[model samples]
Target: MTETVKEYLRIDGTEDDKLLGFLIDSAKEYLTGAGVKGTDSKRYELAVIMLVTHWYENREAVGKVLGKVQLGLQSIILQLKAEGLKSE
Candidate 1:
């Protein structure tokens, strides 16, 4: 998952591996708390990767919002939640 996120972010170093891993876990927890247990593998993985990218790029507490990331994350979360409901 770290590798996937790193590739997605075009990161070429291992120094941030630990931070990336932590972000992945945090993303999973956030999804779970938002009712997106992510039964769909691709969606789940993508969500995690997307979140890690967002967090990695915006480590500072105060920063301008990146275009599409905020909207895309919300959209993916909604999709995951809807799928979870359907499966249930």
Candidate 2:
């Protein structure tokens, strides 16, 4: 597992290592649960990590990021569908 999200969150110390790891794992779990598979998994994982980390740092900007993240997710979904992954 990479620490890109932790670095993005500016958590260079070990004090919040567990929390940061949990957040990354949770992001991966949530994306997997959403049916994000194959090559798209890595792309969505990074997006989710950035989205979650950004949201955690700036809750007030949730509304703004939400649209962008949703658009990204939609693009991922479209790609998946085009690659023959069923919606249901």
Q: Using lDDT, give the best candidate's number.
A: 1
lDDT (Cα, 0-100) at 54 in candidate 1: 78
lDDT per residue (tens digit) for residues 1-88 in model 1: 7888888998898898998888888888878887887564797888788777777888983122356876887888898788778877
Misplaced by over 4 Å in model 1 are: 62-67
Per-candidate TM equals 0.83, 0.59
Model 2: per-residue Cα lDDT over 53-79, one tens digit each: 756666676424565666876676566
Whole-model Cα lDDT of every candidate shown, in order: 0.78, 0.62
lDDT of 2 at 48: 66
